[model samples]
Target chain A: AAGVIQSPRHLIKEKRETATLKCYPIPRHDTVYWYQQGPGQDPQFLISFYEKMQSDKGSIPDRFSAQQFSDYHSELNMSSLELGDSALYFCASANQGLYNEQFFGPGTRLTVL
Target chain B: DQQVKQNSPSLSVQEGRISILNCDYTNSMFDYFLWYKKYPAEGPTFLISISSIKDKNEDGRFTVFLNKSAKHLSLHIVPSQPGDSAVYFCAATVYNQGGKLIFGQGTELSVKP
Candidate 1:
């Protein structure tokens, strides 16, 4: 019954600042994915990790980097943030290879000024 | 390009009636599709899903129909209840996409009593 967990439910930052968002996937889940949903837009795939290795990438910007730690937790680090970066960031976890349902977290709303 | 799409931005249906939401995709390689429901401030919750090998899947009051030839999928909610009102997102994954989901613009449904 445990779902993915994300830190700093809401974050505010100024232009050129940096922010790090953390995620704790459900226990035993081996895959983690990050998505960004801008106002009035669909959730866009940002990146993913499988068993602590980066497995895929999407429209994530160059200023953004992410990695999964040894404990299977993941962090998304964004630097030199821009106003356009404001959006709801979500972390989802699933059983890798088994292709199970990806459970999403409550999401972190990032507001860049 | 927007590979996945939901033409309708919103829909309204009377409680106890049926609500239908449609989605389309342009990628023929996508082998899995899913629907997710989201409240205003919460992350999306997995609803139901169908693989490319199946044309239909049902769970409780929800049914999903996939038309592979049309590269389209539809979700039906029977006996619509006010509690079912939310934004529904359609997502797909290419066979080799490795857990990354490409999402469509969501459709907001309002069930009125």
Candidate 2:
């Protein structure tokens, strides 16, 4: 099946520590997106990468950043992780032409203590 | 501000019954709408979608109805099964730029067999 893949299905980190989540888009997909879902809340867009460049960013803080490399693998890096930063992070891959449907990864649940 | 909103937090339905999930959006510019089903510990999977040009779209037993005048949409699942129990999320896209989906707080559906 054509689906995005994410590493480290779950992670635990301490406050003030840094964390990195990785995602590999489906083959031939050019647009990658990241979202954070907090408890009882909708998944909020964090940032989007297209052609290995940042195209749009959501209302997230600067402490959250995402990068897409040439290999089409993307990483979400959190600097100075705070307690509130704990949430489920999802990565998605989509072909620009097929913007209506985006296949998502299983997501990484991050817990900061 | 929340562009997409799912007013119901949870719904319970018996097997073989019809389940209706509702969503409302504040943005009139949004032209595309989609529904996703997310199981516990997994990312959401695409269910169905509809465009502004059409009022209804159907796939198998799932159907999406759009009421543009009211900026509202609904997902109907007929003959609901226990396997259909999951959190359902409503999402909308504006301008169709690489599928930047604004999502609503999901509604949990419990299909009782």
Candidate 3:
């Protein structure tokens, strides 16, 4: 079974730079979610989209924004990156239903210097 | 204000034994719960999930027991195998919220042969 896919499995950036992370959700999956996991911490919800529309938001920083494209793919854009932004970024997708069990991607490791 | 928590940081079990991982939550509005197994540098793999209306859900060797009154949930893996060693995360979310998951700190399970 094909799983969610993320681009640039590993990314390195400097402070005040900009970075963009892309996600290709599983086929037929209409909902996408983004999360950040810092060192020694659990995954934190960043934002989510459903049917190419912004559906919910979480603790995502003001410098970060995301949107789902017409093809059900999503991208997370981070500007003016800070060292604190270094972490593992994950993308998950699910078919909206009663259960809504999400399938996750391998994750992108972002290291900000 | 961590809404979800996994008190145990790690657990070791001999092969063929049962592995029990626990999780707790402080949010009453959370209507859905899930268990995920994750390996290093990979995304979380969904194990099992139980809705708030049910007390138990079983899938093969993995079973999830939910206690709504106590706001707690547990995952039991019977006949544990060495291949089952990984970090297990407990997650929850509110229904109709675009399926944004709130995850616990995770518990590492080591099944030794």
Tens digit of lDDT per residue, candidate 3, span A1-113? 99999998999999999999999999999999999999888899999898999888999999999999999999999999999999999999998783348999999999999
- Candidate 2, residues B1-113, lDDT tens digits: the string is 88899999999999999999999999988878989999877999999889888999999999999998998999999989999999999998887565788999999999998
lDDT preference between candidates 2 and 3, better one: 3
Clashing pairs in 2: none
Q: Which residue pairs in candidate 3 collide?
A: none
Cα deviation of B65 in candidate 2 (Å)?
A: 0.6
Q: What share of the true interface contacts does each candidate keep?
A: 0.66, 0.68, 0.78
DockQ values, each candidate: 0.76, 0.77, 0.80
DockQ of candidate model 1: 0.76
- Which has the better TM-score: candidate 2, or candidate 3? 3
* TM-score, first chain, each model: 0.97, 0.97, 0.98
Model 1, residue B6: distance off in Å is: 0.7
Error of 3 at B90 (Å): 0.3
